[model samples]
Target: MKHFLSINSCSSQELLELLELSIDLKKLYKSNKRVLCLAGKSLAMIFEKPSLRTRMSFQVAMTNLGGASVYVKPEDVGGIGKREPLKDMARILSGYVDGIMVRTFAHETATGLAEYASVPVINALTDWSHPCQAMADIMTAKEHFGKIEGLKFAFIGDGNNVARSLAFGCAKLGMRIEIASPAGYELDKGSIERANAIKPGTVVQSSDPIQAVKDADLIYTDTWVSMGQEEEKAKRINDFQGFQVNMDMLKAAASHVRVMHCLPAYRGYEITDEVCECENSIIFLEAENRLHFQRALLKKLMSSN
Candidate 1:
């Protein structure tokens, strides 16, 4: 729990504890109770990749907790490790801010910041993983179903960062996760093996989207063309033709199956416009949980107690 780098970095108990804390914080907020656990604390947010949710959620989470956040773009710090080493920036920021949150392209960048910072460092988003998003997603599922364990979660899209992080989170939380992707876009063997090690038989991989969602309680998807993959947009669309989560795919899933997507969704692409607005979609709730989950995370990581 020292740093929120990856879901695998946390034990099962820690993950459960975070979920509990997130629920408690969410309740307090909804009840109009003022939470000032991080009073006088400051967070430094570094963005190597542009984000709407990640940026707003962390900043607003800190504000909600009676704290402040400073947004640092690439040019603001001379490009994280360009003019100065990551260690230097980490050490320097630690002196000023109680915590650091970074949304970057390389996974190593986050780890590098944590390596030198005296304060806690959170991985807002990395090319290899999106731990916060996965945690919030689990929270959303728990809220919807009143529980999470033993649920069948199917991820039908690119086996990208979101899929990998969900696999790790689900394995730790006793949920079965099946990831479906095209041949070249499948989750890496090492990640699948690592997730399975946490809870044997928890992670399953498939090439058939329809078969993957069979009997699934939750079906998830993400954009096929991510930030750096824009050049491959046309090719990705062609490769992921049959992978879109439409009404037909939902029909194949369990009757109570709910849909989720990390936002900035491309309608008629990875998911259909109808599906995005459908009764089964909890995408907006999933997005809102990001604020709640990060508030709990900030309290956990920054509180002196």
Candidate 2:
């Protein structure tokens, strides 16, 4: 069995195939294709942290494909490696569910689940990466722009999980990405190095958002602080003060620029309502793609040999 815990798990061909499948499924949906495609398959999702988008999107994707979900909140799932060992739980759950997904604090946790489980383990989120979100973002790019490579994408704001995944994935598909973040809030150095190793000249990280945005076709931004970083919210807000993506920043990019956000945004903080509501704002479309992307991913990972 194969798993999709990270973008690196599959070759460039497999990645492209998944994107093509998303496109096909989307066209089918537009033609009123109904009923779940993966009716009998089940995905056991375990979230150590709470979420709105990940949970809802995955559940809906499963239901839309003729499948069902069994959500295991942190407590319900033994709080992850507490009530029993991770491997033990993995051994047990793999037998019951067709696949497993865990949104935990460490990226290693997802890897551990995949290591122990006999079934595929998807990474809904791990502190270090968001492979699924990257899929949707890329799918949107393919749907709108018709290609991923050679397009310049500037990610302005916090360089967190989404940034890491996007950096790796864009590199895999031959896209040039610039990450502009505050000095202390920059993307993981490891992710940058890994992306460079995957494809030379694929990723560049810096602290200058405006410079990164210049000549870029796509402008992407995320929240100043992540879900678990609430304790440092005040500090992050001050640190990311000039990093906000408003109209001024959008106009700094190319005339054909399109805006994207993973959503659950802060109205006037990292992004202003004016920008998210703009004609170029494809943020909602990106959000909606989360479901289609997951459907395609589930279809691939759950497919039996």
Q: Estimate each model's TM-score.
A: 0.99, 0.96
Candidate 2, residues 26-83, lDDT tens digits: the string is: 7888798864657788889898888888999899888878888999988786678888
Q: lDDT of each model, Cα atoms only?
A: 0.94, 0.87
Superposition-based RMSD of candidate 1 using all C-alpha atoms, in angstroms: 0.7
Report the error of model 2 at residue 35, Å.
6.5
Per-residue CA lDDT of model 1 for 214-256, tens digit only, reads 8899999999999999899999999998999999999998889
Report each candidate's C-alpha RMSD, comma-separated, in the order given.
0.7, 1.4
Show pairs that collide, candidate 2. 36-64, 36-65, 36-66, 37-65, 39-66
Query: Where is model 1 poorest over a 10-residue stretch in terms of lDDT?
Result: 32-41
Report model 2's TM-score to 2 decimal places.
0.96
Worst 10 residues of 2 by lDDT: 296-305
Give the Cα error of residue 37 in candidate 1, in Å: 1.2
Error of 1 at 160 (Å): 0.8
